[model samples]
Target chain A: MVVNGAAIEFKKVRKTYGNFVALESFSMNVAAGEFMTLLGPSGSGKTTALNSLAGFTDITSGDILIDGVSIARVPTEKRNIGMVFQNYSLFPHRNVLGNVAFPLEMRGVGRAEIRKRSLKALEIVRLGGLAERMPHELSGGQKQRVAFARAIVFEPRVLLMDEPLGALDLKLREAMQLEIKQYQQQIGCTVIYVTHDQGEALTLSDRLAVMDKGLIRQLGTPQDLYDRPNSRFVAEFIGLNNIIKISGSKHDGAIVDGLGVIRFPSEIQPSQGYLSVRPEHIRRTPTGGHPAIVRQAVFLGDAVRYVVETRNGAELTLAEPRSGENSSLDPGSEIAISFEENRLIHLPE
Target chain B: MKNRPTTLLLLLPAALLVGLLFVLPILGVLSLSVYGDSGFTLGPIRELVGSRVSLVVLERTFWQALTVSVICVVLGYPAAFFMSGLSTKLRAYLVYLILLPFWISILVRTYTWIIILGREGIINRTLAAFGFSPVQILYTDLAVRIAMVQILLPIVVLTCLASMLDIDKGLVKTARSLGATPTQAFVKVFLPLSLSGAATGGIICFILCLGFYVTPALLGGRRSILISNLIDIQVHQSLNWGFAAALATALLIITLACLALFRLLTRGRTEFSSLGVGR
Candidate 1:
């Protein structure tokens, strides 16, 4: 079943358990065929949001619309959404073929059709020959593929994955992340994935929703989130950085602050906002910017990261290429460090 | 091989106990059935096949045991399923109620059935108070069947329950999510999964029923006499030890056969993990 261009809309959805609000008036729009990951830590309501879409959970209030149709009362079976769990909840009693065929069997598909469809699904996962084997006989990666195959066997409108690759090792997780993303793109199914890992979200999702404390903190493309981070949380979370909270003002087209006045962009509005600078963005300058004492310089294979304590006592991290590095300043040596103004994101008030 | 001594030490006591209490008696009975009185004789073996009285008792005993086992399974399956549906705390208490009779002596349990089914018992008295005639209950074949089923019901229910509880709850939820109705999910998943346990329990009940003596003797009349009763009659009243041993041997052989058949029927099911024990 093809999902038309209708977006998934959550209209003032709220979920509560007694006095604890799991999701407070959560609302978002997921465009058709878009891959979005709800990235958050535990108990951040990312999983709750995914569960609400899968119909495994009922919201305490409000309606969820899929393809412009209200599905608040629709049961999970009729929701036409595939779900892959974190632990890969495959039926232990059934073989791989039987597990993949479960969806077809539930829909009362005929015997020949069930076999044909299950084989096709297993073939897609490259597990066609292993269809006779039970789940316990397979490795973590193989079991996860079987889970994906099962989720996609019936061609649902959307796919919901609750950290499907969370159980795999680093190498396998990376491979499966690419594989799952390929399947989603190939089938053009809307994917609502939930994971706390920023790397996974950045690698797989077309658009990412950074969630914290039961709310969507930011929803944008990975480049938008990484390049133009709108909050200290998004900046510090999406990448490694030195976040300096300093009072500053716009004067003569430059941001004048506690460290020193540096040339910022002309159109940049200087206000009481946190400035986030990436470690790689900072460069060693000659006698111009903030004067800093080099505290530590650790070589990390391809690059060297420096920890500097500015004259104002604020610490800044700078990364440079390991080869032909100009800075020979030791721990006690003092130098000047400057950063680009465009990389600094203004935090919300 | 290094830990053989420790293993042997741990198993030696059990081995000796079974050897003395179980294997030794079976060997003795087999020898007595073959070697018989005066000398090794085939008279008892011949008599076991030729005697009309032995044949009739054997037939009645087999049918009664089979009937009682079937009744136990038919009633126990739904009871156990109902129990599994209850909350954990309530199920524990209900299980205790089923097992209360297990703690009592078999003789006491058998006699309690007698009182309940007696003409002057509460049931018949209630019927009489309603101006109805008292139904004959005690010392009948039906009385024997009821007593056997009651005594063996707990084993069936507990066995079935163990199997049912072993099923993963997620499978049911997954089934429901895959568009299966509640009845379909249970029939296709839970029922098949629990059948192995029910079969094991039923076999055990049948085997135990085949060897019943005290309950049937206390509750049933002449028509309800089973193979064990015939063995008892030959050994005590008829003074025929060889014939009695043969009858015992037949019962033992039939029980083993039933167990083997049960195992064969359920071999392909992964849930029947303990079928090796039946062999």
Candidate 2:
């Protein structure tokens, strides 16, 4: 539809239901046409933020500006936004074409124009052939497609999705994810997506905010969060990683982490915190590092993951690619591992 | 479900009860109209068609039943809508409140209406105290209609409330997000979805009104008498059991027709009106 999306700004918004604070100083600025996902576990402030923007939930304080206009007093209908609910929520009384045409009809569009736009929107979702079918006749995936068509039929400037693919099966969910990205790109509408799935957030978002307990834990691109997570929670949430607590750090490269004093990489140092390293970064060496024993070996098709325990009783995982001429390790096999010191990130407790 | 013998066994008690209490009597009544001691004849049907009083009373009864059903829908739909918005606990309590009248005997409820609308009753007595003279509402068409409505309102309300509760609230929220005003959402989405329930309830109310005898017998004036009252007179005063059986057969046939229509209206609507079990 080539919509010129609006820039959205949430200025220190807060929402509370009696004693439960849903959002506290939740602020974000989304550029037009950007896909920003709010990623979190359930009960985080992400959904509250989206609901407030759509006027579904009132912000206790602070203001929300779309493009530059304050919409605090604006009703949900007047907000001029479209939302795709988690459940399809297609009107059972209407056919697919009718469902897609509803928004335009509400705006009092001409019949011919409404039909033209609705068909075009349905075509975008690959559901043009099922226009005459009732909602229950369509399968779950088709219903989701029709819901998408209905949301974007009017070509709203901004769209909100609340775990829209939560109901789909694994294969269908993966397929729909790619389709949703393509649709968003074609429409060029700013999408504020909410999901608890980290993989979905990584695949679709231009930027994402990870929230926990009514606050944003971290906000950045997928690469930034994956490569250098700023907290232990984010490190664990974003990807599989090994975190070793740094009990002490010396003026040189020597760091004590309860195991023994190991000479860490000096160039990126000068702190006492946890050592965050990805499994792929720690590799088995021919000799002299830390001696460990493999506890479990799991076959992951592309790589073999081994759970290894150090001499000090710390369990750490490491993965080795199957592409190379590498032999799989058995449980109780003795091995020595070394970290890629330069890739290790320091996180404050 | 496919076990035929078990299915018949499960239905045995109900089948026996209906056969003894309902079917045999209905067959006898219907036979009385067509088969007399002399020979099988259409004499009772002919007399029913020729009698002007019987025809007028039948037409009046039909109109009164239709009016009562329509009034029940109009009054009950809004009350149901209000109930559906309440909290779960509060809604449960209010449903009991509305059903309170259903616990009382229909005869008692009809008589209670007399106390409210009769001369020297509460309404007329209050009017007199306010310096207006007593009005003749005691044994009028209005009094009968009021009593019938009060007696049947509970069924309509429960049916409407049931369908309203089935509706997914997400549809309304989705409508609002798609730029529909609240009133437009309710009119275009909620109203159409809920109409099936109201239609079924109206048909149920209409069927009940068709055979209504007690309220009209007690509250209606001579001019406002319905088909049931006429049938009563034919059996008791005129001692014409054949004509009364014919009138009753007509009422039973019409009620059956309405029940068929109600089934037709409620069955196919599930295809569209029932929002599919959400994804």
Candidate 3:
């Protein structure tokens, strides 16, 4: 099947519910055939943005364009954007084949073509044999797959998914994530997915926008946001990080009030902010580094995580592979911790 | 398992009430239909079959009930649809409005329709002021149907609204996202899901219509007398208890048959439970 991919653009879109602003001046250009995710906590406007694009919610201002044409005034049906909701909203009265064929039927596709294409769509989702089953008879994963089949049967230009796998179990969720990514690739349709799971966003999206308080905090590739998050929120939200408050600037470093002066990378503009470093970046040394007593050691199967408090009363967490050298570090043991200069990320307050 | 006796004991009061007041009375009526003064006889059954007036009234009763149920569904469905679309606060107020008639007795409501549809009533007086002649609508089948629909409409509307509200709003949104226009989405997705509720409402309305006595007696002419009124005449005017009992049994059987047909039509569908009818 030939899938049409449309370039979607949100040109300063804003949505407000009375005095509450759900989305404020949101703007982004999604490339054709790209799988982009809007990752945020609940009430962060990620779903609102997706709903606005789907024509489910009207924007208070600005415009949403699909394929360079403004669809602000277009009704949801005419928008031709397929959406899979968090709960699979399959019509209970219709069987699997009828549900899958609904979009084609609505678009005036002939009866034979609807049947043939619906079966083909079900085949794509590996649900061909269950065509006669009602939605209530299908398992959760099968229902989700049927929802996917229904969404893509018409080969819409854009597919919007709003936490479609949120209701599934962990194993099914993981498998479906891979399946969705593969389907997006095979169909070559532009996908705008909404989710709060950072791991899911990182694994499934070509690029993602991290949203907070109705604004985009950062928009970049998953690794870009993970490695070089522009804000403390992004840094903490993307992955586990130890953030040390920068009290002041010194001659060649920044002063962390209790941890002494920490050297800053030359590229970092010195200011009152925070120094963020991944837990794995902190290395345990035998001596000649910051002297710290291990407060707690947690065995995580693959790695040993040690929470240490420095002599200056600053606490830091470090992780190390469960090897013979560092696996037995117990609480209250005096250890030294150090970090590479390049691994220290400077995030503005 | 030990609590089964306690459950049965707790159910004793309701069981006794149904047995004494309902089951025994129905059994008496059934026996009265077949038994004469001496012993078992089919005299009442033969009279029910032989009487043209009884047959005409029964046919009229069936058609009247069917028409009234159809009218109730037609009027109630749109009102229920509109009510379901309202916000909770607004919907609560609308439900109160729909149920406002329930506070008044059915006889009082039928009487109010009489005052409105009478020759010199409010509507006819208004028509006279507009220089239009009175249309003789008071003692006609139209008057009884109007009165019946007015009294029974709230039940149908509430039932339909409950079913429509039970439906997931997201299904309609899904339909729209699947490229169905608003009308198509309503016609294809919403209509089918809520039909069970409408059917429940219509069935209730039809059953209620079948037993209608006061409205037809007061508003209907001789030609519009329904089965219930005819049974009333047989018992009171003719002093024929057996034939009246026979007519009552026939009406009961027809009502059960209608209910059975409805159950068959909605078999295996769980959405009908949302109607809060038929368990």
**Model 3: what TM-score?**
0.96
How close to the true structure is residue B241 of candidate 3, measured as C-alpha lDDT? 98
What ordering of candidates by DockQ runs from best to worst? 2, 3, 1
Q: What is the per-residue lDDT of model 1 for residues A1-349, given as tens digits with 9 covering 90 to 100?
A: 2333336888888888888888888889999998988998888899899888878789999899998999999987788778888888777767788878878887878878788888888888889889778789999999999988888888877888998999899999999988988877777888899998999999999899998877888999998998888888888889787776546664543343446555445465555666677898898898687889999988787888889988878888899877775544578888898887666556643
Q: Against the true structure, candidate 1 has what lDDT? A: 0.82
Instruction: State the lDDT of candidate 1 residue by residue for B135-211, as single tens digits.
Output: 99899999999989989999999999999898887677666666667787787667877888898888889889888
Which segments of candidate 1 are over 4 A away from where they belong? A1-6, A246-273, A286-288, A291-300, A306-317, A324-336, B1-4, B82-87, B270-279
Interface RMSD for model 3 amounts to 7.2
In angstroms, give how far residue A4 of model 3 lies from its true place: 3.8
TM-score, every prediction:
0.88, 0.95, 0.96
Q: Against the unseen true structure, what C-alpha lDDT does each candidate score? A: 0.82, 0.89, 0.91
* Model 2 per-residue lDDT at B11: 88
Name the lDDT value of residue A269 in candidate 2: 50
Lowest lDDT sum, 10 consecutive residues, model 3 chain A, at A262-271
Please, what are the lDDT tens digits per residue for candidate 2 over residues A4-90?
A: 999999999989999999998888999999999999999998889999998888889999999999999999999999899889999
- State the lDDT of candidate 3 residue by residue for B86-181, as single tens digits: 999999999999889899998898889889999889999999999999888888999999999999999999999999999999999999999999
Angstrom error at residue B11, model 3: 1.9
**lDDT (Cα, tens digit) per residue for candidate 3, span A289-344:** 88999999898988988899999998888988886654567788988888887888
Q: Is the docking of candidate 3 incorrect, acceptable, medium or high quality?
A: acceptable
